[model samples]
Target: MLWRGRRQSDNVEDERSDTGGSGGFGGGSPGQFRIPIGGRTGGGSSIFIVILVVLAGWYFGFDPSQILGGGDSGGQITDDSGSEGGGAGAPASDEMKQFVSTVLAETEDTWKGIFQANGLTYEDPKLVLFSSQIRSACGFASAAAGPFYCPGDHKVYLDMTFFQQLDQQFGASGEFARAYVIAHEVGHHVQNLTGILPKFNNMRQGMSEADANHMSMQVELQADCFAGVWAHYTAQKGILEQGDIESALNAAKQIGDDTLQKKMQGYVVPESFNHGTSQQRQTWLARGYKSGKLSDCDTFNNPI
Candidate 1:
C-alpha cells in the first residue's frame, strides 16, 4: 500500500472531464453516457435479460467486438485523442489518480515478469477513469454498474467513486482493498490475453441461465485468484504491509454475491449468484496468494 512516490502508469486515461454526452453505440454524445436502470425482479426472462446484460459487461469477459465491430487484439494504449495526457485533467489532488496509476504500474511489472517467465509476452491494459458514466465498446455503463474490463477495447473502465462506495456501502476500506479492486479488473485483462474468456463465452452459448451464471462465477473467481497472484508478487517485493492481505480478504468477503444479495433483499438465492459466494471468493483469492502460480488459479477445472 506504500503507493506514493512509486511509478505511475502512463496508460491511465482521465475521462472524467468527458462527461455530458454519449457516443459509442447506444447513441447520445461523447460524455452523455446513460443507460436504463430498472428494479431487480425475482423471476422471468426480464430478470434473466437484466442479469445477462449486466453480466455481459458487469464483471468481465464479454467480447464487445462481436457487438461493437472491428476486433483489435493488441494491448497498446491509445489516447482519447492520438496523444497521451501528460497527467492533464487527472485527479485534482492527484491522490486517487496517483494511487491508481502506481498500482497499475506495479501490476504491469508483475504480469510482464510472469508472462515472460512463462514464455509469453504480457500486454499492458489501459485503465480508463470516468465519472458518473462512460461509453465502452461493450456498451454504455454507469458508475452504479461498478468497475469492469472490456475485452473488446482491451481496457479497464473504473469510476473512482466506487472506492467510496466500497468503503461506505460495502464496508471494504483501506488502500490494499482499493488495490485489490484494480487488480481484479486487471485480472480479467489477463484472462482475455490467455484466451480463457473466449472459450468460456463459447461454452456458455448453450447453457441454461443458471449454468451460465455458474460459468460466470468461475470466470470471476479466477480473476479474484489472479488479483491474489498480483498481491503475492507485491508481498514478495516487500511492498505489502502486515494487514494488506487482510484488507484484500475483507474486500473479497464484502463484495461476494451472497453477501450483497442478503444486504439488498434480506435473503439469499444460490442459483442466481454469478460472482460466487463469500467463502468461494476468499478461498480462490487466498489460494492464489498462497501459491503465487497461474496454474493454481484454474477455477474452471476445480470446483468452488
Candidate 2:
C-alpha cells in the first residue's frame, strides 16, 4: 500500500477522545437531537443517538423506526461518534489513525483530479473515526455493521475495529484490503455528489423488498468500481506493490452478500442479496481498474 509518509487529510475528525462537545461525528451543523454519551444529555445529543441507531439498523437490514420503537421520535437524526469494546471506548493508535488519514488524502487527490478532468468540481468529504458505535447523518451505526457513508452529511463513518474484523473474521488482511474498505465508503460520497444515491433512493421507494435489494446491489457494485478507479490512479503513480490488487479483489469477494450469508446461515438467498455475489464484485472492480473510466462503471445499465 505504501501509504505512510504521504499527505494526511485535514478532513479527518478524531472523536475518539470522548471529551464531549458534539463529538464532531458527522461534521455538520448542530441538530436538535443528540446522543447521550455516558448519561449526559442536552446540546443536541439525544437526536444523534437516535439517528445512529436508525442508520445502523438500515445497514443491518432492519427498519430504524421499527427498531427504535416506531416512527414517533419527532426529530431528524444526524452524524456519529462512539467508543470501543462491547461498548467500552478506546482511542485508536496514532499509526492506524495516520494511515487512515493518509489513505483519505490520497482518495481526495485521485477524485479531485478525475472530477476536474470531467469538468466537475470535487468536494472533499470528512472522515469520522469512531469506536464501538457512532452517529451519522443517515443514523447511528456500530462497527458490526461495517463502514458506511452518510449521504445527508457527505461524511464517511468508520469504526477502526472493522479493520481487525476484516483481517480476523473475513480473512481479508493486508493494507490494500483496508484501503479498499475506505475507498469503497468514499465511493459512496462520490455517488452522493453525482446524484446517483438520491435517484436510487427515489427509485427504491416504490419497489418491493427484493427489488430494492437488487437496486442496492447496483449501488454497492458501482461504489466498488469507483474504488477500483481510485486504485487505477494509485497504480499509475507506481505506488501499488505486487499483489495489492489481489488483496483488494479478495476483500471484494469476501464481503459479497452471498458469501457472508452462506457463512452466517449456511445458505445463500439471491433475492435478499443487496451487495451482489463474490464474482460480480470482483468483476466490476476489475472493470474499473482496467478501464479507469467512470463511464465503464454503469452497473445499472450493464449486466454484471
Candidate 3:
C-alpha cells in the first residue's frame, strides 16, 4: 500500500475524456443504433444522463459482445475497443485510479519474479478503470457486475466506485482490502496462463450446475490463495505496513459468497456457492500468505 512516488505505467490508455467516438454504448447494440446525445450542456447532470442512457440501452437489449467486434458488427470491434469515462479537464473521480495502477505494477513485478524462478514468462495484464459501465473482451459489463478478469483479452476491468460500496455497504475499508480484490482478478490471469482455465472450461462443458459451481469454488479459493501470495511478496519487499494483512483478510471475509448471499438474499445456498465461504477464503488466503508457495494453493486437491 506504500504506492505513491512510484512509477505509474504508460500502459494506461486515457479514454476518460473521449466521448463523441465510436464504441459508445449503442455501438455494440444490434441494428446499428445511435446514442441520444445532449447538446453542449456543461453540467454534472449531463454525465449522469449519459450514464442513464447507457444503462437503459443495456437494459433494453444492448449486447456489448455483438458490436464490440466479436460475433458480428462487421468487424468494427478491435483490440482497442470501448472508451474510459469522464470529460475534458476532468480528474479521476477518486483516488482509486492511482491506487489501481500501483497495485497492478506491484503485481507485475511480483509475478515476473515468480515466473522467472519457474522458468516461464510473465505477461502483464491491462487494468481498465471505468465508471458505470465498460465494454471489455468479455462483453459489456455493468458496475453492478463487480470487478472481473476476462481471458479473452487478459485484462482486468474495475469500476472504482465499487470500492466505496465495498466499504460502506460491505464493511470492508482499508487499502490492502482493495489490493486483495485486484490480486484476486490477477490470480485468474495466472490460472489462464498456467492452463488451469482451459481445463476448467473443458470440464464445465458437461457438468451439472451444482458440479460447475463446486469447481468454481475451487477456482475462486485458489485465486484467494494467489492474492495471499502477492501479499507475501509485497511484504517481503517492504511494501506493506502494519495491519495491511488484517485489512485484506477482513475484505476476503466480507466478500465471500456465503457472507454476501446471506446478507443480500437473506438465505444461504451451499450448492450455489461459486466462491467459498468466508472462513474458507480467509484460511486459504492466509495459507498463501504464510507459505508464499504456489504449491500451497492446490485448492482442488485440498479441503476448503
Candidate 4:
C-alpha cells in the first residue's frame, strides 16, 4: 500500500516511552484468582468506567455497562520493558506511528463517506498506541491481549510489537496485513455506530457460551467484511498495490480463532470460536472486497 503523504490522525495518543513503578489494585480481592497488576484508584474512577460503558451501551443500544467496573481505576503503568527506546526507536517507531496514524485517518475518511451516503453522521474514534500495558475503559490490558476496540471509550488500543509478532510468529509479514488488523478493529467501531453492537449484546444475555461464541463469530466476520469494503475503496483510489489483498487474506487466515486454538492447544473447538474459521474469515473479507458494498457483509443473515 502507498500511504506516504497521506493525512495522519491527530486523535492518536502515544504512551509508549513513559514508565512508572509497579502498583497493584488497592481494593480488596474481588474474589478473582489472578493477582492485580494495575493500580486501583478510588471507587470514583471505577464509577467513571461504569459511566463510560453505560454511554457506549446507550450509543450502541446494548447494556454493556456491566462489563465496566470489573476492575480498579487509575492503575499504575507497569515498567516499559518491551517499549521502544526513545533514542533507538525514535527513528523507527516514529515512522510506524506515523503510518498507523495515516491509516486511521484514511479509515475515518472511508467511514465518514459511507455514513454520509447512508444519511448518518460519522463519529470519529480515537486510537491509542501503547507498549507493555495501558489503562482503558475496559480496564487494564497487557500487550498479550492483542489489539482491542473498547466500545466504552470509543478507542482502539494497539501495541506495535504485535506487528512484529504478526510477521515473525504468525507468518503474516506484509504491511497491509498489519493494516488489516487495524481495519478489523475499526470495523467494530463501525458496528458500534450502526447499532449492531448493542443488539448483539442484548441477544447474548442468558445465551449459552457456545451460542454467544457463534454470535461473536458473526460479528467478527462482519468486521472482516467491512475491512474488505475499505480495501475496495482504497483499491479504487489506487492506494492498494497488487499483493496487498493477498497479504490481508494471509492475515485473516493466520489469526483465525480455529487456527489459533489449534496452534496453541493442539486442538480445535468449533463451539468456542469467537472469530470464525479461517475460510469463513477469508471468504467474508473477499466478499466485501469484491462487491465494495456494506450490504454484502450481513453475516448475521447468511449461513457461514
Winning model by TM-score: 1
Q: lDDT per model, in order?
A: 0.69, 0.66, 0.64, 0.66
TM-score, every prediction? 0.79, 0.76, 0.75, 0.77
Full ranking by lDDT: 1, 4, 2, 3
| lDDT value, residue 45 of candidate 3 | 7
lDDT of 4: 0.66
Give the per-residue lDDT of model 1 (tens digit) for 1-304: 7766555677888999888366556632121111101112111011123223323322243221222121121112222333322356333456888889878978887776566544567798999999988878767877777787887778888888988988898888999999999999899888788776655655566677777777777778888998997787777666777899999999999888788878887888787877777899899999888866666776655777
lDDT, candidate 2, equals: 0.66
Deviation (Å) of 12 in candidate 1: 0.4
Look at candidate 2 and tell me the lDDT of residue 60.
25
Best by lDDT: 1
For every candidate structure, what is the RMSD over all alpha carbons to the true structure, in angstroms? 9.7, 14.8, 15.8, 12.4
Candidate 4 residue pairs in clash (backbone atoms < 3 Å): 62-198
Q: Which regions of candidate 4 deviate over 4 angstroms? A: 19-93
**Cα deviation of 176, candidate 2, in Å:** 0.3
Residue-level lDDT of model 2, residues 87-183, one tens digit each, is 3322244788878877887787777655554456789899888776777776655555567777888888777888888888888999999898888
Clash counts for the predictions, in order? 8, 22, 1, 1
Error of 3 at 235 (Å): 0.6
The order by descending TM-score is 1, 4, 2, 3
